[model samples]
Each structure stands twice: as structure tokens, then as C-alpha cells.
Target: MSSSLAQKLETRAKSLGFDVVRFTNANLPELTGARLQAFVEAEWHGDMAWMPETLTRRKTPTAMWDGAVSAIVLATNYGPEVDPLERLTNKTTGNISVYALNRDYHDVVKGKLKQLAGWFASQSGQEVKV
Candidate 1:
């Protein structure tokens, strides 16, 4: 990707409240697939049958889409203002997963991703998928 486009993407991601943004090639190392296979073989995935079913695609992003040359990984910080682990000590408030605390996180991230994807398409004149 062009440096200008990448700079724009990073700026957009920051504006969208994303904490971190990274770019990497779509092709993962062979070690990744080996480790995933080992994890599955050990039954560590448990009931996540989809993990094994889509192992190939997951190991290599380009395998899922031939046109995808690179990947843009963005992480958003939607953590609670206060310590979530503090609930574990207080019996009155049951402990809950951090992700569960913000149920609408998926929608919020998806909307931002869609907006970034649109911007990327507009800048690169290429199709983008979030």
C-alpha cells in the first residue's frame, strides 16, 4: 500500500478511537499453521469446531482472498474506566467478561471499520473488506 494511504488509514483509525493500528503481509509464517494444528490436535479449541474447519483460511489471510496483499490490524480500547477485576473481590457485583460489559462493541467497531473500508476504497480505488 502507498505510504500516503497508510498514513490516512492510521489517522482515521485514531479518530475512530482505535488504540493501535498495524500493517503486515497477509501471508503468515508456516509456524503459525503448525502451532494451530498442534493446538487443535490437543483439543485445546474445545467446542470451537469452526476453528478447525477454517484452519487453512485462518493460517493465511491471502488463502481466503487472493486479492488481499496485506492486512491492517486495528485494536480499540473499550475497557471500563475502573478496574473490571475489582468485581471479583466484591461478591455483590458478579464478575463479568470485559467484552460482555460492552455488548454493543461489535456494532461500534463494525461501523468504524466500514467507514475506514470506504475511505480505503475511495483512496486506492480498490475493493476493501473489513
Candidate 2:
């Protein structure tokens, strides 16, 4: 993809609340698949049955979609207002995972992804998947 397009995508992603946006080819190293396979065999994923179920597709983007040639990575920071380690040191206070303190990040990020994908598809005249 052109740098101009990448810049536009990053700007749109930031506008949509993403803290970071990166672009890369869809291909993943063979070692990535091997590592995942080993992780599944060792039951490192635990109860997440879907991980194993989707292992083949998870190995590489092309496994999921033959036409996939590029990848757009997005991230959002969910840092807590107060340092979690500070709370950990205070035995008198109850501890809660930072994720539990706000709206579900998966849903939040998914929504933004959908919007960004729509915009990108329209701009590039290509199909997009989340």
C-alpha cells in the first residue's frame, strides 16, 4: 500500500479512538504457526477451544482469506487512572482487573474496526473483513 494511504488510515483510526495503527504484509513467518501449534498441543491456551479450532486460519492471514495481502493492526490503551501496582501494594483495598473497570474493550475496538474497514473499503474499492 502507498504511504499516503497508510497515513490516511492511521489518521482515521486515531480519529476513531485507536491509540496506535500499523500496517504490514499479511504473511506470517512459519515459526508463528509452529509456535501456535506447540502452544495448542501443550494446552497453553487452556479453555479457549476456539484457538485450537481456528488454528489453521490463525497460522497466517492467507489461511483465513486467500486474497489477504495486507494487514492493519490497531490498538487502544486502556490504562487505569491509578497505577495498578500501587493498588497491589495496598492490602486493604480490593483488587480488580483493569479491564473490568471500563466498557468491554473488545466491543469498543470491534466497533471502531468496523467503521474503519468500511471507510477503507470505500476508499480502496476493495472488500474488507474484521
Q: Pick the lDDT winner.
A: 2
Colliding residue pairs in candidate 2: none
| Tens digits of per-residue lDDT for model 1, 44-129 | 99999999999888877887898788899999878788987777888776677888877688798899999988988888898887
In candidate 2 the C-alpha lDDT for residue 31 amounts to 99
Candidate 1 worst ten-residue window by lDDT: 94-103
Q: Clashing residue pairs, candidate 1?
A: none
Q: What's the TM for model 1?
A: 0.83
Cα deviation in Å at residue 55, candidate 2? 0.8
Per-candidate TM-score against the hidden true structure: 0.83, 0.87
lDDT of 2 by residue, 26-84 (tens): 99999999999999999999899999999999988898999899888888886777787
lDDT values for all models: 0.86, 0.89
Error of 1 at 91 (Å): 4.6
